[model samples]
Target: MSTGRDITALVRPPRSYFVNAPMGNNFGAAGDVATQSRILRAVLALAVEARDPGLILDDVLQWPAPFAFNPAPATPEAIAKQLRK
Candidate 1:
């Protein structure tokens, strides 16, 4: 079974999922670091405010590291280069 299916199978009883679209998509036309950060913070706040016991599949939370790049790139190629060693 696929990892996604495995995960889906593990979710029992009450289940909740949280997902953040790619930072670029979340930011929209003029998406920037500030905008992306704001959206991420909002999602975190919601998860914290939620009182019920449920899973939150927050993709942003799984980010390898924090967003610290200055003058963020505008394309996938640029972003990939930035992530390289």
Candidate 2:
């Protein structure tokens, strides 16, 4: 399963699953077992049932909230500022 649909399309694996979640939380939220299990089962089923090559089955599950990622410190000055945070 993957969260990067563009990357997955470029890679073009024989069988893959796409989950609409944050990068780190591909299966589901950190502690939501039910959602994770459902996504896992769907991925597994896609692996078994997908017949065409480069087929990507999209997950129906949705992330509950907006995901915001902090920008990485790219420069020395930025790094120093981030350290202060």
Candidate 3:
């Protein structure tokens, strides 16, 4: 689960963001990709719903993974830089 601070930041941010963590013990397990994809799709749907409802003031972020065994570190600034490419 994402920390309260992280979720707060997501909700406070002006732009949309997608946060991907790691699956639990099921990491690398069979059908993990399908499961993760489904999770992402659900999040996307929620984001769409929020937008349709004009709830842009709320958080439109996705936390696809509940656990991260060896996660990479990337700050929001770094991600923004990448998006400029």
Candidate 4:
């Protein structure tokens, strides 16, 4: 078993680095090398710093700048339409 899609919530990983960005480009925004490295380092550091298991730490940086992302479903019908499609 455990061959299907790996759900995020279900899989209790020992260490997790949650980013504010989308699933596509979570490390950084576009070509932001600095931002990417920062995130990576933080995650790597967690491996050593983290003593407890199954800990999910949120990204320290709160992404301020707006980047092109999938807009949230505004209406109930819109949400249903997306689910249907």
The deviation in Å at residue 14 for candidate 4 is: 1.3
Query: Given candidate 1, what's the lDDT at residue 76?
Result: 86
Find the 10 residues in a row with the least total lDDT in model 1.
Answer: 20-29
Best TM-score among the predictions, by candidate number = 2
Q: What digit string (tens of lDDT, one per residue) describes model 3 on residues 1-85? A: 2223355455654333233433342123346686556545655665565543222332233445465456579989999999999
- Predicted candidate 2 versus true structure: per-residue lDDT over 1-85, tens digit per residue: 7888899999998898998888888989989999989988888888788889999888887678877666775999988999999
Per-residue lDDT of candidate 1, residues 12-68 (tens digit): 324343333324454322435775576567666665776665544433433434443
All predictions: root-mean-square deviation over Cα?
Answer: 12.0, 5.5, 9.0, 7.9
Please tell me which predicted candidate would have the highest lDDT against the true structure: 2
lDDT of 4: 0.69
**Steric collisions counted per model:** 0, 0, 0, 0
Whichever of 1 and 3 has more lDDT, that candidate is 1
Clashing pairs in 3: none
| Residue 4 shift from truth in candidate 4, angstroms | 17
Error of 4 at 45 (Å): 0.3
Candidate 1 stretches with Cα past 4 Å from truth are 1-17, 20-31, 55-85
TM-score, one value per model? 0.30, 0.77, 0.30, 0.62
lDDT of 1: 0.47
Q: Tens digit of lDDT per residue, candidate 4, span 49-72?
A: 998776777786656775554667
